[model samples]
Target chain A: MSIGIIGAGQLGRMMALAGYPLGLRFTFLDKSKDTPGAQVGDIVLGDFMQAEDIRRLAGEVELLTYDVENVPVQALREAAGDTPVHPAPAILEAAQDRLDEKQAFARHGIETAPYRPVDSKEALETAIEALGMPAVLKRRRLGYDGRGQHFIRAAADIETAWEALKGAPLILEGFVDFDREVSLIGVRNRSGETAFYPLSENSHEDGILRLSVAPAGQPALQSEAETQLKALMEDHGYAGILTVEYFEKDGRLIANEMAPRVHNSGHWTIEGAATSQFENHLRGILDLPLGSTRPRGHAAMINCLGRMPALEPVIRFADTHYHDYGKSPRPRRKLGHITVVRDDRASLDAVITELMPLIKAAEGGE
Target chain B: MSIGIIGAGQLGRMMALAGYPLGLRFTFLDKSKDTPGAQVGDIVLGDFMQAEDIRRLAGEVELLTYDVENVPVQALREAAGDTPVHPAPAILEAAQDRLDEKQAFARHGIETAPYRPVDSKEALETAIEALGMPAVLKRRRLGYDGRGQHFIRAAADIETAWEALKGAPLILEGFVDFDREVSLIGVRNRSGETAFYPLSENSHEDGILRLSVAPAGQPALQSEAETQLKALMEDHGYAGILTVEYFEKDGRLIANEMAPRVHNSGHWTIEGAATSQFENHLRGILDLPLGSTRPRGHAAMINCLGRMPALEPVIRFADTHYHDYGKSPRPRRKLGHITVVRDDRASLDAVITELMPLIKAAEGGE
Candidate 1:
């Protein structure tokens, strides 16, 4: 009767909010007794590595999925047993490692920046030679946002960059001449039926997602993104939501990374689309027929990082929607997001103009 | 931190659903441990009169509200202490008694069917003498749908009607030659700022509400309904949602009853309006600026009484939205509802024609 989620974050909380109206029950497996998801649904407090806890959660629900990509893939597989674990642990495993993610993309004929594994100083030197200057060095696993990446400009900067990221298995990724950052999300069901939402043009500040505009640019770019996404979904046999973030350069989509679960860029779908990504993800996992993925209007989503802004001005806008994650305010953590949706382009732009400054001030930004 | 609701039925369940994305927490007090609201938020199982349980819930939340009119008014007043209770217990008490509700409407210059108190068989005879034959006899408190009414069509029927309802104080009222049944829901914040949703034309079967069409009929009727609603809200010193059901005959509005909390007919506002009645109720209690009350599209809501239909066909529609209140199916009980919203009248009518039969079958209709 209930759906179990591995991580109790904003995405899990939103999924519960969407699923509740459909008679779907929700229970979360979270490490913390108090979490954003716990505020909305039932929580089973335990670590992801606890096999007993994972199995206990699986036994209580009809199916399993996750909010975060950092979960232990094998534990999910082991716990799922005869039950369905959507988007599959294999997909999570591929998304967990940067080297494997890029390699998987290449195998699926999706373009990616050239990269090579770097373990020792000799391997790093060889990779630098092959990838060229201004290459980025990153830890292969447990990396998020910009936490694990260091840019190497020249040979002199190598030692310091290596000292900063040494101990973990690393990958050197060559920099691409990208014009803009965009993300495409597609959902697939167990029956092989697939639905894709609009492409989201994204902006990140200090490696944290700051803004996303839905139906990014125009139709042609979105079509190409969909083509690449469908290929990835078919190749992996994904059964829930999958998102691929791309760097658009000279009208070409070069894959930067893919999240096996829902992405932050699709938050606008809650108010902008006819059916939200969260509900579609549940529908896909449940193997129900998917809903329409069409956008109702133009949407601009701004993340509320570090602190929650007062909601008075935001709700005053005709079609604006505010979502708070109910997490404690931190220096750089994402606290919430506000989405402004409008049937016309002008109202959308007007709200975006008025909101950016307010959100920026809340985040202690310049 | 959290909003405490007294009755954990579908209404409280929905309030929690709407409030969660706004970073609101919810806790409920209900007699039943297994309630629809318990699936979404914390539930404190206790009777409404249990002061200890009510006090504990009040202690845990920022404010309190109720989903049903059946809760003990004095207990809520006792538990609220200094913490705000929206739509005030006074309004709840007024809504509880049919006589008082009609009197309040009359005080606000809203016309109602002619009525008189009937405490005894002698009083009932005198009331029928003034109101005429085919008058209706109703108990003053704790009645819903058509449960507490009996018709006095002839002299022979008077003894039977009196025998059935003589113990309780009753009201004998003349019937209105109404052309249609419509309801208007208006919300007022503590600041006295008011917003009204368009009138909803409703259809009832066997005294239980069956269907509601939003943005009902013409603008003139909606305006008159809004005017009467504003007067009632102002007279009650009300905050939060209030709904007034009306009988429209000869282009005149006659108030039948008023609900101090969110009403069933306004359920379409969840998906049809830019902002839902649940969210606005929370905003009113918290004194936040209300969201837009404009309709996003035309909406039709059909109640799924006693059973739930298969969800596959419902979600397959591009604009259909399904809600299941996780209660066990029972004969003649209010179960769940489905709302379908569309941008045009043709599609709205098309969906209404498509859904009525399916919902009727699910409810085990005759």
Candidate 2:
């Protein structure tokens, strides 16, 4: 059966590549006629907000899902009548708005940091007072890769942070003294069967993900987080891959945000897991039995941004796995990722250590 | 850089797929527009026998190669001036003719079943008298998958065997009392660096490959064959993936024939090896450093032809791996393959044992 994806970026391209081998064809939609996914998929080029394009995409495929969450919800809702949209428009609506998402988590008895909605000067003042200094002020909708968010360390920085947010619907979240950022990437099928991958500790730089190490060092913390994440997915009747980002503080896991589609943090699964998140997402949307989520080994993923430097050194290492996403090079743009899987964390760490030099060399660093 | 592949079959499609993540693009030449590879690649539709199409394809890419070896030698020669045709026309010339291939092997001190070229009735009589009854007669050129050959069990069957060859250039060979059929697939670069995958034992039915098991059961036997295969390839300065089919009889490995590109028997590498044969083939032609041929575990590959079967059983088994080549279904056409890797022979055997029932179910058998 054919499945239409709403974005033709690298995520869509990867999903298309993964789905094709499973007898699932992909039809991709994007405003750019030559998006990366379009290079390898049956593509329909049009604006995401265009009703005619959404209708055409819905008519052509057995089901509909998206590569990114920025597609207009109203357009998706209209097409949902023709083809089932997994994780549903409601999930995207909640995920799109930071305040709504936090509320959803709170309603489900899922732990999240203290937060207050702020859309105007009065709300901003009230939120700053309630959440206190050292809070994170973020745009309510469509923030990704560390964009559209600011850290407020002092009361004096409130006005500047507010102006940066620019009257967009916003949320001011109380900062948690967390030790690490971990994520739970899992899939729930229509039959209510859920499969969770091992928890991964994510590291970011300049607001973009730098790396994700799977079976994230703390086993008990990872297990506790997965239990809560799966329950939250079941509560929503979510039927697709979901990634819950969280902060681990004093052995307690607190929700930060969620991605309704395959998350960047789970890219290690391509070589490290028995079944990749991309493949599982296809299986979930197709209503097929979910494949295994077992990690093949301890895994670490490093993002390749802009241009991939010389891969010779990484290729020289026995355990380093390279996956170039085939997107055009641009500054700070994620072009691909590398996954290194090994029997122990020590080996995984060694691979990452070895890769640092290669990555630097590729960046034209001495 | 882009490479032009003469055919858009599964091999070419796989080559294109492997090429993409490495910054290599491909333009395909096939009679049919939008063939499987063409769906994800640029297509230049034309007959291989036509010079104009060859010229067009040559102009578009940096190098040229074939998915199948049947492309006319003259066409390849003409394309050579624009972009080098790898494995070279010399290799193809020897490989296409049974007599020439055997003679070349003999000159290299490679062992083979006793054989002689036969053209006329007088020559056929001399060949049979020398090679004896119960020999096989095979048409020399354009034969594959068990076609264009006949077995003579007795003197009475000689005339019938000759008739079956239909006046094509042919060969007569003494029957081999082989215990098993095995093959060695390897790649040689222009710099003369070579890497070889462990020998694989292949099982066939009706001249079509059914399965290939890597690190084939007998270690000593495989090592001996690998050494010989490497020596032969080095002698020819062969580059790209070369597969040499062999027969093991009385503890002796005898050369059978060779294919100049990635062979079906190496399909297990996609999921079972450090780097797939397809990826290495691209690396070899592009003059990149060769990759490791280390098998992850004992790997067994099963061919799926005509229709893709229900994958529930295979998916349920933890060790089983599936790959669908994404080809259109036609009677007796190869659609895809599955590879299973396991820690031991018992687990590997279990997957194979379970696979038969699944295949039968897919074929509508009880």
TM of each candidate vs. truth? 0.97, 0.96
Best by DockQ: 1
For model 1, the stretches where C-alpha displacement exceeds 4 angstroms are B50-53
How displaced is residue B341 in candidate 2, in Å? 2.1
Can you list each candidate's DockQ?
A: 0.78, 0.52
Q: What share of the true interface contacts does each candidate keep?
A: 0.83, 0.38
Residues A17-43, candidate 2, lDDT per residue (tens digit)? 777667677888887756778877788
* Candidate that scores best on TM-score: 1
lDDT tens readout by residue for model 1, B248-328: 999889999999998899999998998999999988888888878888789999999888888987778777899999999
lDDT of 1 by residue, A94-169 (tens): 9999999998899878899989999998899999999998899999998997899999999998898899999999
| Chain A TM-score of prediction number 1 | 0.97
CAPRI grade of model 1: medium
Chain B TM-score (each prediction, in order): 0.97, 0.95
Residue A200 miss distance in model 1 (angstroms) = 0.9
Candidate 2 chain A least-lDDT 10 residues: A357-366
